[model samples]
Target chain A: MEARNIKLEEIIRDENLVYTKTSLMTDKPLSFCPGCGHGVAHRVIMEVVDEMGIQADTIGVAPVGCSVLAYEFMNIDMQQASHGRAPAVATGIKRCWPDKYVFTYQGDGDLAAIGTAETIHACNRGENMAIFFVNNGIYGMTGGQMAPTTLPGMRSSTTPYGRDVALMGNPLKITELVAMLPGTCFVARHTVHTPLAVRKFKKAVRMAFENQKLNKGLSFIEIVSNCNSGWKMTPVQANKWMEENMLPYFPPGDIKVNGEMVSKTAKSE
Target chain B: MAKIKGAIVIDIEKCKGCELCLVACPTDVIRMEKKVNGKGYHFAYMEQPDNCTGCANCAVVCPDGVITVYRKKFED
Candidate 1:
């Protein structure tokens, strides 16, 4: 009997792959945790930019946090901003280059906490830029400290006993708050826990970038992600936990779409 | 109906062995290799290639962006 040997290159040449990694990503491996949603979010944004054919004209601002090194992973023109200052940097870049596509990749700790003022004012001023906010409910890079968006009764390094609304205040629904502002044209909350969720997230991200080309006001996309290392749960378990706990407080869907607030009934219907 | 075929190429060194892909694969074609990589983590491998439907669900969910999927099409 003769044994036949097949090479991987031949298989790749012969097969019709429906999906493959995008060139927008860098050769460097992502430094995010194994199950962290930050990588998925980064890939989605890069994929959107790649598909839109704006890699050369796109400029990304990454604030301090776990996503601080996003510039390394996203193969495009990028700038590093101080902690909680991506919006300010993005604003400046967008103002200087109105024709260029500018965006800010931020984390909950940077955007909702110390950068709160910048975030609110950037949207209020209707900065023509896309803001990708990754909300993991905890300070992932700072050893799982409680963030301003940390849900009530959630446990963190700072809130060991659990986040008490009376003591820690309620979770900040910054996405909804931004939706109320007139400057914001698109505001949506999404997750990356499942294939369906990832598809929806990609659509939202693409829409946010499209709105920028329309010269619409700010487009805020809040991705409710999980920090497995911070949460002290396996990646799979953390996703399950997020679906059960975080989804209720931060429901996944568009809070505002195309300058119109999507009512709760409309979201359900 | 024409039979559909799927295949995957994994960057072993890039895989963290998180097993997220294991759960993402709808057809259970993926599994963790017994051999560990340079990072001392088991890498993902195709245990049952024939079962893959080229859904790309595992690639979509992979945080490391290590998996690349391929599908073969047949005319009905």
Candidate 2:
């Protein structure tokens, strides 16, 4: 009965195998703060990276944020970039090690604010690497400050009275803006808020890495994550905030696919 | 066939007191209590009667390894 449940990998694409042992150990301690979305996102990415069999060739860049310890967590070769320089480092790594898979893990503030320049130009050059951006709507490590994706009227340290559009400016939809660039080929936004979403998110990550494996152009995935401690709300409220305020400003679906902008869910069985 | 009822089982040791699972529960049967667990994080408690459909939304987004759901019946 168990054998029947276990389908052979031969039936699946060599690149699309779903089940596999990951270097992510079961007993290893996770450094992420309790209720932090970075933990879940990291696991998802690690699972896909392992299943895709790219761990040996994959080089990752860790950004400056609550998840900076990512280098210590994932069992892969990685480097720590300055606050928002992950894209630049990733670009350099991809250029020098063209045969290797390159990626950067950045937070909303780091990628959408400080690293926006590097991110913009990387896609402009159509670099063959993936960028995994986590948009949790606030700066977690350096105290809870307003982030590029922080919703208007949301209470934050930098915006104690709530993010005012007239003063602080409207929230920046970073992923969509980057997708507008001509060089970006695969762009998508996903979340781990729901199991169904997690399943779909895995597919998106797999597709992004697949693009890189084939020397395809830049692929970006913006994940709507939760910041439980920083938000001062229970992890439940943080996720609820994402679904209520975030999905509208930063819709959770594929923004671009194969050089074409996809505004809606693709017709897939 | 005896239809099994779905339920949520939380790992108290890993619960970080993040109430995300409580809000995601459509049943509104869960709530955060004022007690901290072994991990020093506030933990949530099942408050509402039996609205839990065991959708596993709570387990899906849990940053901490706290919640798990088991469906009463096996899927085809």
Candidate 3:
């Protein structure tokens, strides 16, 4: 048994290590709820930064919502923006430090609702920065309030009986709306619930950062995530529900790439 | 042909027991521990280490980013 154990240790040596957590992530444990996509989202973005060897040059602006404490988990230089002002903050940072990479992290409540104007104007002006939008429909941080991205008939604390389209208006397809603007160079909607989807999200994140080097206009990535606690479902159930109900409405795809709209049929799954 | 093998190390203290890793794992190589961790959550562990492909699927889908994967090849 001792010899077998030694053999096992020999096989699991450091040289065989295929993957390890990126140093870009602080040793601090994530404060997000169990199974929340915020943690995964944070990981991929940091992974991209670490892979690009741009940790020192990258600055992240995180606004209010569950990710309000994003600076705590993300090891790079980070700035906190007021509720829904991450894009505007990012623009300021990018303008002052044109040589630096800048990005904003915002939730649906902060981005699609409270900061709609900032988000729109920044995209319209084609700010040379990346915007990472996490749209879980409901406001996960504020005890599950209804957000602008909340789907029709979706139930929330404010809409107990379910959101009435006539009263609540329609869920914002902000990704597509931004894609129509000429300022956005790359626009895509993604999720991080599965392995395949996570890989795609990572590529999108990398592309967003790379666009900054080319002076390409704003790159926006909308990650449709799940709010299990607010939705009163288990983590697994929330992802499934999101795949069924949310994906159909927000639909994952590259809305625009390199300033050209991707045809509907050619959309990547 | 050399035989390929894979293994995984999970940081139990950081695990929130969301179970997404289990769903994302293709080979059923991971399982939740019966005992809770310091956080009182049933953390994930390599239940069937021999079957792992080091594909990093579990690590990718892990919301907590607690899993690390390793792969090795041995001459037969």
Query: Each candidate: fraction of true contacts kept?
Result: 0.66, 0.34, 0.73
lDDT of 2 at B39: 72
Tens digit of lDDT per residue, candidate 1, span A14-35? 3476677789999898889888
Tell me which of candidates 2 and 3 scores higher on DockQ. 3
For each candidate in the order shown, give its overall lDDT on alpha carbons: 0.88, 0.77, 0.90
For A223-245, candidate 3 gives per-residue lDDT tens digits of: 99999999999899999999999
Q: Scoring each candidate complex against the real one, what DockQ results?
A: 0.60, 0.21, 0.64
Q: Model 3: residues >4 Å from true position, as ranges?
A: A1-7, A264-268
Runs in model 2 with CA error above 4 Å? A1-22, A25-28, A264-269, B1-12, B19-37, B42-59, B65-76
Chain B TM-score of all predictions, in order?
A: 0.94, 0.76, 0.94
Residues B6-44 of candidate 1 have per-residue lDDT tens digits of: 678899999988888899999999999999999898999
Model 2 residue A255 CA deviation in Å: 1.2
Q: Candidates sorted by DockQ, descending order?
A: 3, 1, 2
Q: iRMS of each prediction in angstroms?
A: 2.9, 9.2, 2.5
